[model samples]
Target chain A: MKILVCIKQVPDMESRFKANSQGVWFEETDLAFRMNEYDEYAVEQAVQLKEQLGDAPEVTVLSIGPDRVVEAIKKALAMGCDRGVHVQDPAAATRDPWQIASIIASHAGDKGYDLILTGMQSQDRGSAQVGVTVAEELGYACATTLVGFAFSDGTVTAKRELEGGIKGVVRLRTPALVTCQLGLNVPRYPTLPNIMKAKKKEIQTIAVAELLKEEPLATTVSFHPPARKGGGIVLEGDVGVLVDQLLGILKDKTAVLR
Target chain B: MKALLIGEYRQGKLLDSTFELFGFAAQLGGETAFLLVGDETRLPACDGPLYLAEAAECGEYNPDLHKQLILQAVARENPDFIVFVHSSYGWDLAPRVAARLKAAQVSEVIGLTDGGFEVGCCNAKMRRTVKPSTARAVLTIQAGAFPARQPNGTPRIQRLAATGNGGLEFVGYEPAEAKDVDLTRAEVIVSAGRGVGKKENVPVIAALARALGGELGASRPVVDAGWIEHSHQVGTTGQTVSPRLYVACGISGAIQHLAGMKKSDFIVAINKDKDAPIGEIADVLVVADVMQFVPALTARLQR
Candidate 1:
């Protein structure tokens, strides 16, 4: 069996973000980057499935970005993927989800992979659209926000998390796609030895232009920090006094309690 | 402009969020229509052309079958905008429909501006206005972002037939396991986030909740860390609660988490970082260590 896992490198969630000079996306120079938290679960799942299949399956990890994305692919390799593919596109950050998904579908359409995995959404765009678009582009069965996954006899059973804490169960035949969500599994840290080994692994680089099949349908008109509403009063002084004041306000004004 | 609102049906009925699309349609100033893969029983009472693909014919939510119906509806209606409620169903199907239509697609729209649709970016610390270059576009509005427009007249029903067989099988839904805790019903919610330190420290926040005669809630990080059960999660992916009073302890207020609880009557946030986004919406921002302050607050309340 063959499997493909798509990973994205996102700026750390806690970083101070600013719009780039182009006013299209966050400035990249000052931000620290790492594999998206959700995609880490996808890579971990792919690696686990390979291990479960006992050396029978080959896992290929793919990423799209400037050269920095090679690091993300390496992390997936360190976590036990067989190889890496990097679609080099300096303008990757500016491309909409449709353009990105079309690039991926065009590249992976004929790869003959039985299963494809991706994070539910990127930490940056958080659109949660690429995997499903890729599935539609490739005409594969698709499921999103998956927390549990099991595979046997050319079929996949995926557990999807819906709103209001409900779980939907779905079964899909092979040549399917699933998006990994948080709590799917604990992503493993790459051991020192594995990191060194992963450095030696082959990463095939392809210019994104060769795979591009669609223009961006959507474009960001402008980006800025969220507007601040009037600031709230800050409670100060002794902790005990703060509590009393808060309780009194809650009781007298909001009437949440007596 | 003409817009098609993709209605969602699940758990045996039409979702209430479906009506909010009409509100968005009104904002966009367009002639609106509706489409649903379920039968007439799930149709919304609205004044528009409603396209119905009965489950008996189309097998609702079978991606290919539903996509075919939507494509047919679009071909006939020629809508400029396709709107969906940014729920799980929308998250899955909107992109597929958009890809097939070769149309622009935007997800998680939180607000409408004269320039364009506003969406959260950079982990919700920033916002961006996006506009579609294409004449047609697909959009998924954030849950609860728009008010629901009341239905005054019945829709003109137009039935559609399914024509495709997809590779996925819809399995039964496993409802959230019955937990004694229901955050929605709680009058007060004292929520814990990563700052609670560890699993052992959860009881400290729970103690505060108990002392206040309220229920304990948690942010996505705490729940994802397995420090608390998923049932207690307060976020876009979890439970949306509007308690009378909300106490956010150590929660930095990610956009999704804020969406879940911002409607509370009164909110008090305790975090060491006064500039945390939670402070923006909080009625009172208390800058202090949650570990030290929560225990004292609980002790005072209990006394």
Candidate 2:
């Protein structure tokens, strides 16, 4: 089985985000980029699945971004993927889900991989729609929020998380798509030797135009920061008095009889 | 324009988030129609018409079957927008339906507007360039993000007969249960993260929760460490919560963790690091040792 794991580079979650003067987007100069936190889980899942398959399965890491995204490709390589394919696009930072999904679907179609793994949503875009959109485009069976998986004899069984403490396990045939949820597995930290080995791993760069026949469907209008939260009112008094004050405030704000 | 509210009904009743979607649809300005796919049962006191597609063989959620039913319903009604709750089932069904209908989908939406809906991006802090496309949109509202209102008086309920090519069949079903506590609806939550040291110290936070009549929660690390169940995890990867009060003990408030519970009514963070993101958002930021502070706070609460 050939498995393609799609990864993305995202701004570090800890960094402070600031939009540019034109309000188009965040300034990327100072932001440190890394493999998306959720994608790490997806990559880990792919690596584990390959290990379970006992040397028969070939795992490939595929990413689409600017040249800087090679760092993320290297990270995936250190995680034990057999090869890396980077689709270089300068405008990747501005591409929306439809465009990104189109690029991925086209690449996956040509690669003819049996299974494609993606994070349920990218940490940066968080659209959570790419896997499904790519599935729709390629006409493949897709599953999301998958916490557990098992594969045997060209069949994949996945346990997906549902709302309200419910879970559903479904079985799918080969040539399917699955999005990895966090807590699926702990991603391994690359050892110094592995990092050194990853530096020499072959990374093949392809152009987005060569990957996809379609143009991007969407464009950004503008970006703005979310509204600032109002200053909180601190109630000063004893616990009982504070509880009363809090209840009164809640009643006033929500107008609930309780 | 009329809008269709696609609801996932289990055991003959609509989910709470479905009602919240109805509340949202009413705000979107239209005669809201609800489509329920399940066993043959009429929904009582709905705001608008309820179309019942009963397929006993459609046991578990089959995306193909749902897409066909939803498209047929859409063709019949031709509503401008289709709304669903951003639940697992909705995640499975919405995109397929949207693709079949060629409508734009906006997932994880927190609010709506006159011109378009305000979608919640997963990496809201990062990729600031990509904006939601505003065509006829398929939207899934985040659970608990929108307030549900019970409009006065019973709504008109019109039931439609089940009609479609039902080609999907369920072989069997097995449900997986997580031992973790579900913290999404907890009224009060006390969570600990990696900073809490060993698994032995987790009970300290639990004691604090007990004293305050609240439930114990954890970050992904504590849960992954096997100290607590995945259900008690209050982070993006775990459960999204909006409790009355959330007390974070020893958590640094990673954005992934904050995305799950940042909307709580009152946040109290107790961390050794004064500059932790949790401290920035807390109503009361206590820069004390969690090992020292948790037990002391629990004792005071018990008194």
Candidate 3:
């Protein structure tokens, strides 16, 4: 079984992010970078699948970003991917998920990998579009928000999370794509020996112009922090007094209205 | 502006958010028609023209079949905008539809504005007003954000079977191991966060919920910590609720949690940190320790 897992290197969400002067994206110089949280689950899932299959099923990790993204690829390789494909371009930052999906599809289309996996969304963009778009472009079946995944009998049985607390079991054709959601699995830290081997792991870098030969679909106008929300009226003095105040309001305001 | 509103039905009934999308489509103005694919025998009455399709394989929502169904409907309706109520289904299918039609796509729009739309970016830290490059678009709306319109008029229903080759099978739905707690119908919810401190302290919070005769909810942290079931979790990946009153205890509201419960009619946030994002929308911001405040509040309510 051949599997392709797509990963993205994003600014650590915990870091204080400030938009650049143009307000188009974050000021990269000050922030730390890591694999998007959900993508780590995707990478972990791929490794676990390889271990479970045990007949030497290969897992290939793919990512597209600026030159710095190779570090994320190396981490995936350290974790256990056979090789890495880096679609490197300094300008890829400005491309929306539509364009990003196009680039991924260009590489993934002919590969005919049995299964393709990606994070539900990028930490920076959070559009949750690229994987589905890539699946659509390649004309493969797909399911998103996949919390449960197992491969058997030439088909993938997946548990998809739905609104409310419902979980649907979807069986897709073998050549399918599923987006990894949080809590799907715990990502393992790469061992020191694997980390050493990751140094020699081949990373094939492709230019963005070489993959996607089209104008960007959406142009960014600016990047800025959203309007700060403050001015919340806080009840002060005593906890008991605040409780009294809340009870009075709930009895008068909400209890009757509903 | 002709807008095609994609309607959703679950468990033999039309979802309320379907009407919410209709309301949003109405606000977008122009000819707003409704589209339904798969077994929609219990289809809600629609105000505008209805393009309805029924296919046997559409039971549990396979993205491949849904994409084909939506594309077939788009070919028939050919509206300027395709609207979806942001759900697991919307997140999966909308982008694919946008690709098929080359429509500019926007997901989770809180409001439609002039020139573009106002979207929550930077993890709800900032709202960006964006203008799409194309006039036509595929849109997935935040559930419960728009008011649902009452359906009225001579319902013109067009029965069209969406293209499905029956290659995929929806093997039915499996309810999570925990008893399913439907948060959407919860009129009042007592939600806790990491600030509840520890696993043992959750009962003290649940006491408030039981006292108030409301359901118990939790932020992602509580559920993720295995302190509570995922059935109680509220957020983008969890359940979206619009209870009449929401008591957020020890919850410094993250934008993701806000997405699930911001629509509640009244929100009371009790976090020690008054600067928490939850306070921004909280009607009553109580700057008190939840450990102290919640017990007192629960005692009073129980009294």
Candidate 4:
């Protein structure tokens, strides 16, 4: 079976993000970059599925971004993906979900892959819409937040996480979309040998304009930072004094009926 | 312009967020319509035109079936805006409906204005830009992002007939049991995080909660560690709470975690590290060991 996995590069979650003077987003220059936390799980799941097939399944890592994104693709290759497709478009960074999904769909549309995998959502956007939208664009059955999966006889049965501990298990045919959740599997780090081999793997770059002929559907208005919080007062002294102070604060805020 | 508000009801009563959405819709000034899909006995009362999609096995949420039902409603009502709460069901189902209708979606919105809306989005990345906007917008209102409002008296309720396309089938459903204490409505909440050390120390926080007659909550880390259920989690990835008094213990307050409980009336954070982000927002910051403070505070409260 052939598998295609989608990956993205995002600002490290630990970075203290700030807007530049132009009122545009720019991570602190001192910050670091890494593969999105969730996409690692997607790549791990893809590699495991290949192992289950009893042979080296042709795993392709597909990423859409600027030149910097090839680093993320190479990381996936080091994790044992067969090859990489890096769609290089300088303007791709500003593309909305529709445009990004369209580009990915265009590549995977004719690839004749049996299964397509993606992280439930990118760490940066957290929109959680790309995988499902791509599935719709490709007319494939799709499931998100999938925590469990079992494959047999050209059919895939997967368990999805729902609200309040509720789980939904569905069966779908081959050529379906599955977004990997956190607990799906522990992703393997790149070994030195694999890392060296990945450098030799071919990376095919596709331009965004070449891939997407239609104009994007949406435009961002502005980004606003969340309001800053006030400083806190440290309460000292014995437990009785603390309780009295705490209760005093609460009583002023809420009307205690009793 | 009119807007359609979709709500989910269990066992006949409207979910709490439904009332909040209705209040929000009233401010936007539109011909608001409410759509409820469930068993006949479980239909909720609505203030606007109510479209009832009844099925024998509709007690559980089936997205495929819901897509068909919502598509029919969109075609019939053709509202300018489609809104749903950012609940688990809404998050799961709204995108599919939006995709089917080819509508632009904006999830996790905090407020609505006449011109557009102010949303709390992770993708906005703490900066504003006009290149990423879209029309036919579908937005999911974040819990606790807006203040809840009382229902308007005498909302007109019009009953519509049930319709089905029969393309999707309901296999089965397992209802999630309701919790005894609804943290979202609790005025005082005592929350624990990974810093509390082990699952065995949870009772210490519970003891403190008992003293203050408050609910017990958890951050996503503790919830994911299996120390507490996901329902008890407070964060962007978990449930959002807006209590009058929120006590966060040992939580460093990641942006995702802060997004959930930042609306609390008074936040008190107790962590060893003084620089924990929770300390910045907390009204009271206790720089000490949670293990040492929790039990002492519990003792004082019991007195």
CA lDDT, every prediction? 0.88, 0.73, 0.80, 0.72
Question: TM-score for every candidate vs. truth?
Answer: 0.93, 0.82, 0.84, 0.77
Model 1 misplaced stretches (Cα beyond 4 Å):
A234-258, B273-275, B296-303
Clashing residue pairs for model 2: A126-B122, B180-B231, B181-B231
**Candidate 3: tens digits of C-alpha lDDT, residues A78-180:** 9999999999878777887788998989898788798899999886777788998888888787888988888877788888877665788878887888899
Candidate 4 lDDT at A192 equals: 100
Residue B56 lDDT, candidate 3, scale 0-100: 51
Candidate 1 vs candidate 4: the lDDT winner is 1
Higher-DockQ candidate of 1 and 2: 1
The candidate that achieves the highest lDDT relative to the unseen native structure: 1
State interface RMSD in Å for all models: 2.5, 6.9, 4.4, 5.8
List the per-model TM-score of the A chain.
Answer: 0.91, 0.87, 0.88, 0.86
lDDT of 2 by residue, B180-265 (tens): 56676678888988779999999899998887677999997688768888768776556888888887888877656886888888
Better of 1 and 3 by TM-score: 1
Question: What tens-digit string does per-residue lDDT give for candidate 4 at B1-303?
Answer: 787888766434556666667767777776877787754453344456667666444444566676677777777878877888876567667777777767777666666544356654433334233322445666667665666565554444444443432222233444543555578888878999888999999999988877777888998668766888766777655567898788898887765678789889888888776655676578888777789888877776566
The predicted structure with the larger TM-score, 1 or 2, is 1
- In angstroms, give how far residue B258 of model 4 lies from its true place: 5.6
Residue B278 of model 2: what lDDT? 66
The better candidate by lDDT, 2 or 4, is 2
lDDT minimum window of 10 residues, candidate 4 chain A: A19-28
CA RMSD per model (angstroms): 2.4, 5.8, 4.5, 5.7
List ranges where model 3 is wrong by over 4 Å: A191-193, A222-231, A234-258, B38-47, B55-60, B176-217, B235-256, B263-277, B284-303
